[model samples]
Target: MTDFASEMRTLIEAIDTHNYNYYTLDRPVVSDAEYDKLYDRLVELEQTTGTTLPNSPTLRVGGELLKGFEPHRHLSRLWSLDKTRDKDGLNAWLTRVLKLVGDYNKNNPEQPLPHPTFVVELKFDGLTLNLTYDQGRLVQASTRGNGAVGEGILEQVKTIRSVPLEIPYKDGIIEVQGEGLMFLSVLDQYNQTAAEPLKNARNAAAGALRNLNPKTTAQRKLNAFFYNIGYSDNIRFDNHQEMVAFLKDNRFKVSPDTNYFDSIDDVMSQLEKIGSERLSYDFLIDGAVVKVADMRTREVLGYTDKFPRWAIAFKFEAEEVTTVLESVSWEVGRTGKITPVARVEPVDLAGVTVQNCTLNNIGDIERKNLKHALGSLVYIRRSNDVIPEILGKATEESDGEEIVCPTQCPACGTELEQRGAHLFCPNRLGCRPQMIGRITHFASRDAMDIDTFSVMTAEQLYQECGVRDPADLYKLTYDDLINLDRFGEKKANKLLAAFDKSKECDLSSFLFALGIPNTGKTTTRVLADHFGSLEKVMHASIEELISLHDVGGIVADSIYTFFRDPLMQDSIARMQAAGVQPRAEEKPAAAADESHPFFGKTIVLTGTLSAMSRDEAADRLEALGAKVTGSVSKKTDIVIAGESAGSKLAKAQSLGIRVIDDEQELLELLGLQQS
Candidate 1:
């Protein structure tokens, strides 16, 4: 008989070593396949021998429902901040800090500035939470609700794998303050479904942490970066970087975007640099947290009843300055979908001047029920900085009655229908805006990416050069382009070269460029792969289209509608006429490989899964050939689980869920035979 208990012990020790390697040290010695085998073996022994260990990862991988959130009185009170939103305000804040540091005499408002040191860090856009761990096990997680009475999530907090159920600290009890965040890509993948994706990372973290099911929270991949010491009885760190390094060594993920500054001026420069690098980070970063270096000096400087006087967060304003709306313009998309845009007075944001903000579709305008008219004050926000959105109406008096969606296309005067909140021009053919938008989409880089032609140039070619469609772009001569504004001979030649180069971008970009309604880049990739060529897609029936992954009802409707549109058909005809053919989709890239070890199998992960969450199983499986199917069908190859699996367990039993407990079974199913 295999001494199952001893095997389980060895497996736990090995898996824990790997966890330390990957999550703590940011280095992994073993492949996920190798790790999976060890994990599965441990589970197998534990189940067969009925032996479970303390702080077992299986129990700790996912958090459970909290009894309820309770208020935790701070060791030191958490304080609300006095914020500075712009350059002038930052200068003022610096001026005040210098005064507190005795840069000025009591009577002097303006004096020579004193040399002071500062720290700058990216202000992560996440929900603020205070975590308390007792003897390595997380005891309480509290929200920074109003800087005081935070909702406690005892059970839910346990689900986050990153939040260790136990730590190796000897302080007995350690309280840390940090931010909980989710990745934008995760949110976007979720948004693909009919259900709305989370609006932002902070909200996602807060909501997920508050969920009753530890499994759902586990699936979210919520991670945290410890930044501040809220309370600790015997902890000691010399400086901020020391704290960071120590936390990482002790299993907490630390922010990697931080830098050391020798002086306050250097810190400010770093702050400016953070503004530029903010958009590039994988996690949310709203601004930088600046702190003084020396622990003794920091103690001497002390803190307010709230924040440390030695540290301050320089927050980048996500909201653009108020701009006056000069007009509301309705523009038609290539699909003949009309959207309202607010043309506003230019106001500086971050570093650029803002003018126009999307009102989304007409439905958004009515849902928010914006009441502003020409000359009304409107606030613009680009919280994530891709698209600027109208915050709300700022004026009491209406300049004119609220503008309503037009019943006809302004460009072609075609009859329109109200589909949801959008007013669509049923006459998709020959509508001026629709045709131009189509041309723009076709030329856009995500599509065929004809680099040479721009929307404005396309317009000029349309009205002045008799180029009414995409095929006409290839017919343009340098002499004709040179005749246009900003188009010198050199510029014209470059544009033509780019347009010619677009031929090689592949079928996915080509289909996306077609700009069919609701058919985004991912959908195009799926369609191109399934059909093998653009020609096949053009001939495929709606039923076949619906069978493809991500071809929801709206996309199916759009596919059918686009093919039926004489204008859309004409455009496709012209593209074929001009030799813009979509190539067959290459093999679907495996998210992982044989070292990944489980590519094509269907794994129905249910309940609280130990070792990793259900989501991690699906993610890892997808990387292999393991399709992480949502529901267990008769086809489900494995059902891996943790404690208290409900309906899924019953259904899996009825449908033969191939239930596997512990990690080793899963590893064997994936064919990982560990030593």
Candidate 2:
């Protein structure tokens, strides 16, 4: 065991160094062949030893797709900055800062201070990412989800070429925070071959980082610019300039246009310069951050409940352009909701050319009081780094008629029905868009776990083979697939194998894969657990479904209505005939041992655990007959508290309920072993 450990440590160190050189420095010390050889050896040793370190480089080669993102407690809280757009607001903020500093200096005469220096930086229009490194090796990366907690995206972040996989500073643990963005050039290149082009760079970057597959992010050429240190152990910075310098010294990318200003006027001048030149950069910037550079001054100012008082974001007004609305087209979704898409004359938004934007629905149009006549001018705003949205009417037209809502489904010509504020096409069986969307959802990675299916394949199957539903996917033969465009024998066989593999999925997945209206994964699990069989669920009444804890009246009615459709019943029959029957687990209450500690007990889990993800832990606890609730309440029998546990743990303590700190202890209490 010691020998294996020694070998593993050496391999990890070598691999990490190579990764740092290749990913961070953009220079390869070793050839790809040599690196892969070392990586393969490390993987083999890890498998044999059955022990892997948290910072193992092999984890970057992400395997199975995740069910969903798990919440992670951050080492340091990430706070949002208060924002202002106009000169009046900026001046007011600056005045307040000056007054506060003067007061602080007067109160503390022993610590006389000079005029505060401010660091001005263009705020990159991208998703916030927090990266933590231990002993100079990157360990974890997460999103700024709710300031206190975030979703872990270490695997995806590792694929970003610009982020250093390893750093020179090995003094304890430190956190580097930055924005992850995709450049406009990269976006344009991606759109040329992308199936569905990204709407904007910011959303594209966010979506790529959150994607379950790291390879997808690597392919997108995502980049990052480190700006601040969220946490450090033994490292200190006197000012924000030093922090940026430290980041640059460690081979991490820093913003190229950061400037230090002593006065608000100089800061405002820099902001103007940045705003004017920001459009010329490869990436997007929506605003400039003006921060008190001196760390002492920042500490004196401190923070409010939501934002930092030491800093403020100077936002640029969203670029608005007026263009002629040529036409309004209705697009149908998988759920039968029809969305109004406006086709406008081409106009420049920021730098990208904009010709189309979402008008949302008939209600949105009415709320905006927009004229629906041809050649009428309409205003669109590309705000908050999102796809340009129709803002309001641009012209006080003298003779333009109101845009009339479509009476029929655009795809199947079926008459539309009004549901709440949206219009729906009820032709579930005949509508092409709905059928295609359902097929796509059913074959989605989270549903049946069919990774090889694509929208193009679904379209081909529908048009050529007369396939209308997901169950028909199983009926596809190798010959049939081979006959389709671009499907060779090898591809056909692989697709066939994926279908066969999906049949072995669990009951919850099968239920979710059915594309029932208003039924998400959680609701699907409730139905699967309550019924224990697909047949039972299909026959159960609304009263039975509504009785389940997670299912409400609307969801119950939707489930009841779905099963009552004869067409859906026929599809299920076809699916079963095609060999797609998923095995259901025995009811937890019935199968669980009565002597288990968690038996018939409500449990609440809070914070981060080192042993496994919260989702996995919850599943295990539930298997031991524990009911895992989200919040702490009087009914909570036990609270499994991990590191950095917050309000839920406090609530449990106040209620005098039992709490377990070690995950192993909790597992032992439930008579289970490590997963």
Candidate 3:
């Protein structure tokens, strides 16, 4: 085993040095991968050691137990810089800088403006934090709280290994300012389990920074790029570039999207270059920042009320691409909500390959005004940081009226019922598309342990091989799948093996896999634990479903709604008839398991988890006979906070519930240790 102490120190040194170079001096000597390896190694060691230094990398992620936040004063009066939200404002700011540099030349007559007169850099969209390093050690970090008065998060800041527990620069007083952003790779993992995934990187960053547990925060893989020295003097630079270069030399993370420009036009060129390059980078940035190059000109130009008089952030317009919309297809889910996917001539948007984009509901399709026949150029846009969304018609001239909802199910030729804008296939057990959606959703990692039954394969099974529902999925044979397109011998066997494994998943997973309307993971868990068997919930009355704590009137209504249909009930009978057993272990009629850490205690799960998958952890927690609930209420005994854990963490604090991490509390409870 590697010595946790030694590796932790080394990563702190390397990452700190790298940050010093990138953020402080505007120069970097290492690749992002190398930096990540060092950081991950340090995190691993810390997890194993569990011996925390006040300045240890783990401590910076924020403690789960919010001690209490009181309004605090700022050391200096913080003020907002004057901001320019568009290119014109940038042009105006550049004009001011040029005039100032020209005036300085006229005043001194001897000093000349630098040939390369401006620094253009990408402006990141993230939280700004202030780090105070005293005698080579990070003393505290605070949010640019109100830019003046900020909350003290000294303990939390210690978790960012790159934040540098100790800087090599001794006896130097420097406060570094940087924007904190969560990486994209981390965000995708979060979206899979998130009930409401973040819309963009800024949202992810906001969630991560506010996380109560530093351990949970660490999992997000947040990075920072220092843009300025909030306070540091005596060390001088000939130009802004030199100052950026100096910060890089001092071991701070810096933005790579920086360019030198001798004129406004040249700055514009760099800004355009950044526009093209922005999608390739991991962090979310709205636009490029332009600043006067002359060191003295920056001082002379000074501040506007909300932004720098000498600096401006010129934002790029949201990226739009024209593509031929080849087809408008309806994706009918198990719940009968139809989402129109605009299949287009394969076009690239931002960084992702985009051949399809959502048209939301039937109304959304009408608003876009795509007539039944397909080929039309449509405007598609996604903020460099957002999911690709269709931006209406690229063809401005169109007498296009909305396509009528199909009278029959496109897949099964059954009648469609119009409740609202949505056309539902009330033929629940008979709809092929609905069956495909339900089976795929059931086998998904969140619902059950079906390892490799992909949506594509599920569709193939339904359409080609005569499989309709999840119960039908259990009847699939290896040869049946192998006969389909692209299903070679090996993958078919692998998929079949996965299906076999899924059959054995605990009854709770089976119930969740059923994809019953309004039956989410929590409700399924409660029902399973209460009834101890799928047979009971199948026979449950509306009153019995309502008796569960998490199930209120709406949920009760949904359960009764699912059971009211003879076909739906017959389908459950069929699943049972097919030998698929769904049953939960009923909690014994007893007070609480004191040994069951969360028994009789109210608990709330917030954010995301690493190590044990969030669903698996929650399942295991309930298995231990604990009451796992959503949202932190006053009755909550503990809060299991995860990565990007949001408002629940705050509410838990307001209610004074003890909070624990997924890795620490949940994993340990489940007998899995995070390393």
TM-score head-to-head 1 vs 2, winner: 2
Candidate 3 lDDT over residue span 90-155, tens digit each: 677666766876777788777765543778777776766777766667776776654555656555
List the global CA lDDT of all models: 0.66, 0.80, 0.67
Best by lDDT: 2
Error of 1 at 331 (Å): 18
Model 3: how far residue 78 lies from native, Å: 18
Candidates 1 and 3: which is better by TM-score? 3
Q: Listing every candidate in turn, what is its Cα RMSD in Å to the true structure after a full C-alpha superposition? A: 23.0, 12.2, 14.6
Ten-residue stretch with the least lDDT total in model 1? 666-675
Decreasing TM-score order of the candidates: 2, 3, 1
Q: Which stretches of candidate 1 lie over 4 Å from their true place?
A: 1-9, 24-26, 49-54, 60-67, 74-76, 98-116, 192-196, 319-380, 383-675
User: How would you encode candidate 1's per-residue C-alpha lDDT over 1-675 as one tens digit per residue?
Assistant: 356666676777677778766754568999999988887887777677676676556764564455555655545444444444466766676666666656343444454333455556666665666788777767787766435445676565555556555667866777777777776666666657726566556557657776667676777777766777767778888677777776776777667766786765677777888887776776776667776665654665566643466666677756455777777888887878888888888876633457887777766665554654567776777643434667766655555456666778988998888877568897755788877787787887566767666789668777777776776786777887888877788998998788777756578677778777776654676677678877788877889987875575667878877778787687778767666656875656754544232445666666554344454455456655666544556776666664435565788888865665434234323322111
> At residue 81, what lDDT does model 1 achieve?
46
Off by over 4 Å in 3: 1-168, 171-224, 227-284, 287-327, 344-353, 367-380, 391-404, 428-430, 459-465, 473-500, 547-554, 564-566, 574-579, 585-675
Going through the candidates in the order shown, the clash numbers are: 25, 0, 43
User: Candidate 1 local accuracy as lDDT?
Assistant: 0.66
